[model samples]
Target: SNQSLLTQLLSGDEKFRIASFPTDLPLNGMGSDAPFEFASKQGLMTVMRHVHLVLSRLYPNRPVFMAGRSQGGVAAILYAQHYEDLAGAIAINPPHPDPELFRFTVQYLEDKANVLADLLHAPGVTLHDRSWEAYKTFTPSFDYPSMRSLSPILTLVSLGDPFNLFPQYAHALKAFTENDAKNQLYILDAGHNLWNRKSTDTYREVINLQAQFMVNQISKVRKAC
Candidate 1:
């Protein structure tokens, strides 16, 4: 029910108009018993349904861009893959639903459990089943949610994100948009931990970058019309 950490941070920039909220009751660190499927679908649909609708009504003539961090990032990318209601979408260090990702991330973490669920469990913070099951067998993985078919999204990568390094971030950014040349892949010189002071500053920079990208995308769209 609260605005996301992303919103809290981005609100500092008065130049930008922000309308950020939880992707679902399950995300936003609220925690949920939502099974694998519901966790994935609910997050994406909340944006497509509630958030987008609210923003569209508020700014009917304005192009709306969506951006999310981590799980929220996954939702943003997934929403764009299925719908064209957004002007553009940006995902920052979105960890894919891949078992290998967790397995690989273990080498850098103190907890080395190989079980996907346990490996990712954050105790009382948030996230469902550590998202391992959803990553492995979610319906989207089987039939429709192919990154290859996704519209161009600004995916920012962190070379230091243990769970999703720049190289592992490849598959997510492999897809080309209609304007192939504009599918920009930016590698930031920072880690994925946005909780600390240093990381938080980097996140601020990322938000600024996202704001600039959105302005450019909106301009291009207006020009094409």
Candidate 2:
């Protein structure tokens, strides 16, 4: 289940060399902070910087594409926005900055503190002070208009997902990229995890579609050169 959509793509396509990196944030209890800290702007930026540094050193001359799920998806979008040389970005179920959602998540965590503690069972699982500050400062939804100027973005959203606030986020992103023919927003009939269906048919179809889009974009760039 840890395998992502990008992983599926890489396995199916032999011509493309893909790299997947961890967020390296405490959000998943992998760090000192409690779960969900990685949802903050600070957490996202930290991962983005790490990704940029790695890519710069390892594949400086090669065209790079970013793709991810949930918070990782948000990071991919942000990275694509900052780097003009990126071929493109594919974000699945990304969450935008919404004050109400933030408030709701904080409240949910607070109410479920004991449950979270039991689940994570790691050191420094308490909420970090910086997370709250980052929430107030790093709202990406406010910058959607500027993001329209960045590289092409393809957003895949699931209509059945009511838990992650993705529909609104995808709608706003689609609006920003409305004028760009290269950018697209695709809606799926599943939930937050698009590949959760018992039948692999839907998952295979989505992955194939994404792979085709990425190939087309890469071909266009090569022709332009």
Candidate 3:
């Protein structure tokens, strides 16, 4: 969704091949129905399945890395959880599915009742009821192996960004990866749209930092392999 806005960042990077999947899908739609979760599993499965097919036909035994931004970030992480072959992942401002955070965000938006929420109904866009219900399913003690088990998940957040800021974001990061020193967190100095010029080039700087970190991660992985 935000990929179009991020074209400048996504483009001109040939060293690492990038693929974009367009949709509001989630990792698995077993019980929830948010626009993102509703389509996530199918979209990720479809993308990975195609990648598998392509690799099978071309170089059958090659390794690959996956990364995603916004909802795409969630998809990337979900894809890695399901696929053991995912070498590494770089997820930027992935949605935090914590119930309290979700509630707070909804209340915050509803309080503002802005055009954005009115036009789109967002996050809870489709399955507003079901998604809220599903969110309640999560608890402080809920076990999230998918997040914590991801050995090399790199999470980036912006201090002023309402989307990724919070106990929920913190929990999501913790859930996906542990407190190991291997985990790296980068805090940018702007709001959600870092690439925006109004942010005084903070977004571009974040992009450069993320790129360097990704390169270092790849090099470390290569050495380990």
Candidate 4:
């Protein structure tokens, strides 16, 4: 699904190697790495920090950028919130990290006829109890103004995403973010998934725009330095 997106980011003859790994979070489940406890947001960030360290070490000369979609996108936001060393992050349709908004978004998915099961995880008519437990692992807590991060973020959200009401979010999450916070949100024409499947044309365009945003952002930083 993200093949076009990844390729576009690596376009322009750039030597960007994505160190893709399955995050032990419920989004992708366990991978080859020995599974450890990471039910809390603290636990989640602990693993993410290790991944950042490895990336920084492996590519010492490069500015590290994080990007992800859906849950992965939330991970990217979480990453930017904690790490000033990051160059930037691109979050595509991440659910809110606030406890109320996040929980509401979760329930919206549950009510919407297997959207969670089909789109977010395995296909099933009913979301399992185990799935709910995965979400319980995190005690969601994030405030835009108090974030300890300095890196900028580019957030892309679909205009029609019912799960996270854009209108309501604009007052708090979006409006507050613009009042000096580094995160930037851009609305797209697609549905909740951020892809124009009915129109069938924007997946590539979305990726290209994201790539361009990254380039422009990096260029500004380099010039500033």
- Candidate closest to the true structure, highest TM-score: 4
Superposed model 4: Cα runs more than 4 Å off: 1-24, 27-37, 98-100, 113-126, 136-139, 142-148, 195-200
Shift in Å, residue 201, candidate 1: 6.8
Cα TM-score per model: 0.63, 0.64, 0.60, 0.71
Sorted by TM-score (best first), the order is: 4, 2, 1, 3
> Compared with the true structure, what per-residue lDDT tens digits does model 3 show for residues 69-108?
6555665656655565555666676666666665676565
Candidate 3: Cα lDDT at 182: 41
lDDT per residue (tens digit) for residues 14-35 in model 2: 4555565544333321234445
Show how many residue pairs clash in every candidate, following the order shown: 0, 0, 12, 1
On lDDT, the candidate that comes out on top is 4
Can you list the residue pairs that collide in candidate 4? 39-137
- Stretches off by above 4 angstroms in model 1 are 1-16, 25-43, 97-103, 106-145, 148-152, 170-182, 194-204
TM-score: model 1 vs. ground truth: 0.63
What's the true lDDT of residue 86 in model 4?
80
lDDT of each: 0.56, 0.60, 0.53, 0.62
Q: Which has the better TM-score: candidate 2, or candidate 4? A: 4
Residue lDDT tens for model 4, 1-225: 345565555546655544555554554221223234345556666777888888789878567778876566767777888788888888776655566666766667567645655543334534445545454344354333346446788888775656556466444456535764677777776665545455556676676677777776666767878
| lDDT score at residue 219, model 2, on the 0-100 scale | 70
Against the true structure, what is every candidate's RMSD? 6.8, 6.3, 6.9, 4.9
Which residue pairs in model 1 clash with each other?
none
